[model samples]
Each structure stands twice: as C-alpha cells, then as structure tokens.
Target: MAQSRKKAVKKSFDPQEVLDFLRQDELDYPAGAKKFGKDAIPFLSDLIEGTDENLSMKAAYLVGYIDDESVGDVLKKAAEKGSSTIRIAAAYGAQKRSPEVAEAILSRSLEDNNPSVVKFAMKSVSSMKLGKKLKSKIDHISKNFLDDDIKNSAKDLIKKIK
Candidate 1:
C-alpha cells in the first residue's frame, strides 16, 4: 500500500468578490476580504470615495481590517473629506487605529457639518483619552451646535471628560 500526501492549496478571490463581501451591512473582524490584506486597500479606498454612499460607508468600515498605518490615513481622510454617511462610518472605523490617529480623525468629525458625524465622533471620543483641546472642542459643541441631539451628546461627553 502506498501512502498519499496532500498539499494545501491557497485560496484566491476576485477583487469584485471581496468588494461584495465588504459591502455587507453586518460584518465582523476577520472578514473574508481580509484575506487580501493590504492589497485590498486601493480597491476599498476607491469604494470609500465612490459615488454610492452606501458602498462608500461599508468600505470605510471595512478599511479597518487591513491593519496598516496607511489604513489609519485612509480612514482619517474619509472622516474629514467623505460624505456625511462615510464620515460617520469613518469615525467608528477609526477606533481601530492608534490613539493619535483615532484622535485626529475624531477631532475632524467633531467639527463636521453633519450632526450625526459629530455624535458618532463623540461616541468614539468617549473611549479615547480626552485631551484639553478635545475637551474644549466638545465644550464648544455642547454650547453651540444647532442640533439638539449633538448638543446633548456633547454635554454628556463634557461631563465624562471632566
């Protein structure tokens, strides 16, 4: 009797397939698209900056799975420059980056014209080390933002910061 040895085969995914996976509404870490690693960054960035707000938002969240310093840059940029929906997703996605990177993104989000982005930023800030500048920014929002929800959230965050 002869014994047989089996060799493992590497699985490959088409870029479109990975994009489809990342576009899902509910996803956790170790997402199937993560198998592509940094290679997925460009594709994901395109989607984040793309026309479809829904896909852009999902891509922003999925960017965190790449685990690269550039990933922080991408999320931060999306937080500052993308549409309101993407900014909200970017604010949450940024929590996975380093403290400084996350703070940079959150700071921009705090000033976003969209109240929802500011609210999401406040939520992210609650987990970060609130600095004097951030505390000041939140204080300003608590006092001046036009939206009642964001103003209230900023007030709550100010209490937490103190």
Candidate 2:
C-alpha cells in the first residue's frame, strides 16, 4: 500500500514537494519544471497570467522547458499578445526550441516596442540561419531603428543572411 501511495504522490500533486523544491536557494526551475513535464502547463500558464510580476515572468520562461507539442503554440501566443515582460520571456523561451520553431517569435520580438525584447530577440536569432523574409525585416530594422545597438544587431544579421 505504501508503494502504491508513493507512486500516486509522485505522479499526482505532492504540494509539500513543490514548495520544498522551488524554495531551494539554487532552485533549478527548469529541472523542477520537468518533474511534472507537460502536466505542469495549466498551472504554469495560470501563474504567467497571474498578477504577480516575478512569478509570472518565471512561469513564462518555465513554459519553454515543457516537453509537449502544445508548448509551441502557447509560446507563440504569449510572444505575440502578452505584455512586454511576457514578450521578453517568450523570446528567451523561444531560444530553447528549434530555430525553425523559434523563428517567428524571434522575428516578431525584433519588431517589439520594448528595446529589451528586441535586444534579447536579436541575441536569440543571431545564431540562427535567418530566412529571406526575416533578413529583409532585419535590413529594414538596421536602417530604421533608432537604437544603435539594435540597429547594429540588425545590420549584423543582414550580413549573415546575405
């Protein structure tokens, strides 16, 4: 009975375990997040949609680590419609996925109003072999963006794309 109970607790919610694991000083959120794998999505999504600033941001990034098919669409939506904070996290999270999978989020983030989002998105896309559409957008950004850092990043991307 004890073995079955342990299995149930591990598979299900052991509230105390979550508190203990997440509260650790060196809390490896990615590792802890994968504990529940895809099952943690609804809870993490709630936290991202919640009003708490820090928690929302953390949850937003954690969603990227979920090994599930649904995570991509979820990240894309957040990258597109979420607040600047979530957008930034989405950019960061998108980097965890394949370049092809992450391309759209990175491209949109490069066009974001938030400089931080644009900056981080540039960093994410920097290593990817950008497609023509994205290269053209980068060229435009290089020519039009006011921030030298972002403009420089766009210019760099243009060189690589060519």
Best by TM-score: 1
Q: Estimate TM-scores for all models.
A: 0.84, 0.80
Clashes of each: 0, 0
In candidate 2, position 101 carries an lDDT of: 73
- Candidate 1 wrong stretches, greater than 4 Å: 1-13, 23-25, 131-133
- The collision pairs in model 1 are none
Per-residue C-alpha lDDT of model 1 across residues 1-162, encoded as one tens digit per residue: 122221111235357776667667677645643666666788889888888888787778778667888888888789878788899988887677788888888888888889888888887888766545489889989999999888988888787767
Off by over 4 Å in 2: 1-10, 13-26, 131-133
Q: Tell me the tens digit of each residue's lDDT in model 2 across 42-159.
A: 7767777777666666667778877776777777877887678888988888878877678878878877877788877777776555545577667878899888888987787788
Q: Indicate the residue-level lDDT of 44 in model 1.
A: 85
What residue pairs are clashing in model 2? none
Compare the candidates by lDDT and give the number of the best one. Answer: 1
